[model samples]
Target: MEQPTLSRATNPLIDALVLQHLQKRFPQSAECLQRELASRDAAAAAPPPTNRHALLMLLAPPGDETPLWATAYAEVRDWVDGALDTEGARYKPELSRLLWPLFAYTYLELLRAGAREQAGGFFASFHADHALMRRDELNQLSQVSSAEQVDASEFARRLLTSRYEVRLSAFSRALLLGFVAERRLQLTLRMLNERIKLALPETLAPSDGGGPAAVALEDD
Candidate 1:
């Protein structure tokens, strides 16, 4: 079946604010995303387990035309459905595995924002964890490791790289308060993306051939 293409103009004000946060706050992580894009070679793709489907559905951001959530929902949904068959069978993992690495970028940004510290701990609340895992029995979900061997430096590098690539998703990059506070903008964008990706619907991914499609929210 053919799908509707949800394209639009970029919002410079929003983009500019986002960039400002990334440049000033999470400089290192922003750099990493940029580097990965520039190299045209990303870290190895991680295999998707059965539980990921639920994560995608739950974390998906709520939007269809905005760049970050829209693109992320589409990409994540594409990866999950492509992994399953009509009879609900499993297929070997593919390059779509990039999603895991991408989310790792999100995780890094959140750490920079100090989300853990804000909530009185260094990780998300156990309640949030339970909600995310309930989707797949996710008993093994949290136990699973992120795709890359990440550290603070690596996170900063990826984020900066994405900023330079200028193709980042709005869902993944936009956060609460919309950059009123610069200190945590980078991490806030990252976490918002992660949460929205967790809530994505299955209809987001495109069916045509192209590099993975990204929704640019700015109006041109």
Candidate 2:
């Protein structure tokens, strides 16, 4: 089912007001708004087009096609499911650690995609996943709902900019990346590039202490 779209055109006066607000209140993103208008079907009826037919286009400022979070979230969700399934099960414990960060990123991606309401819903639907181990991070992530909120929340900002520590033996990392890459899970690759750092050991030997372990962050 299609999610409702937030952007729209209105009656002439309201349309002008919307344009003015975009240009005046968000000058930096104004160009994106302009390009959004420019790239649409050039011949569509002006005042009624967005309101009538192309609301999803409003969700993306201009060039981006129905922001990735809109549809791809489900794809990425399924991809994660596949990555943790029988074929990839050997790395399940190590890969499991990425879940919390991936969970946080899902919300960010939804926000960046301009699916604010959807982001909230997505978060609510999965809130139970935040167990005792993830309480702090979960609390921090819960405070964020928009792009500005991300900048304001230190934890949210770190989730976006810092490297998520994925502790795994070298062989596991190779297997995971190689499988995803070979399978062409593009969104998973994007997640790795944007949200995590693969933390490996200095030596390839098995951990003297058993297997890899998650080190608590200074804040945690």
Candidate 3:
């Protein structure tokens, strides 16, 4: 028997109609067409390639004395701070507020990891930048040298347990998110996803009003 073959016209509607007709007239070809359709659909639905390096690095056991958390934290923080600092002054205030919470959590995360020396260096390097807004909290947090201290201190415990909220204009939120995604800063992304709560306002009001918006700040 001569088998029927479909001639693809490239028009979705026409192709579907032809496929249906072929299937009805030739039951054997139906299975082949169905498989092809399934393959195409699966390909279309597959997710884009993701950079899993950061996630893997975070989840993998530390095989050496390297302070992965502290290093990741510093890279993410410095990039974010530099990013916001370069933005227009108008959006700077709303976006820059993210730094404080990020800083606090990064420092605490280092301490919790038993990277006391790394944590101290991190604190000293950036504490002054946040001192104006979080001086007392910074001072108190600096005293926390280990995970045991974090558990015992009320201030440290509260910050770790609670989510820090930040509002951002929709545009600002997109810009920030796009930057992180492009950079593949998974640790920073994890922090934003798990620890920070973002409040996105629909419309950013100029002057008087406005709106919008990792490191794998994780524990062992």
Better of 1 and 2 by TM-score: 2
Q: lDDT by residue for model 3 over 63-164, one digit each (tens)?
A: 543265556556655654554433333555556667777778777877777787888787788888767666676788778878799889988887787787
- After superposition of all CA atoms, the RMSD between model 1 and the true structure is 17.8
lDDT digits (tens) for residues 54-128 of candidate 1 = 333333444421223223433443534452333222111222223333343444433434343322221242224
lDDT of 2 by residue, 157-176 (tens): 66666666666554445444
What is the overall TM-score of model 1 with all chains considered together? 0.23
lDDT of 3 at 142: 77
Alpha-carbon local distance difference test for all models: 0.32, 0.52, 0.55
Model 2: lDDT equals 0.52
TM-score of each model, in listed order:
0.23, 0.54, 0.60
Tell me the lDDT of candidate 1. 0.32
Residue ranges of candidate 3 with Cα displaced over 4 Å: 1-89, 201-203, 206-220
What shift in Å separates residue 41 of candidate 3 from its native position after superposition?
27
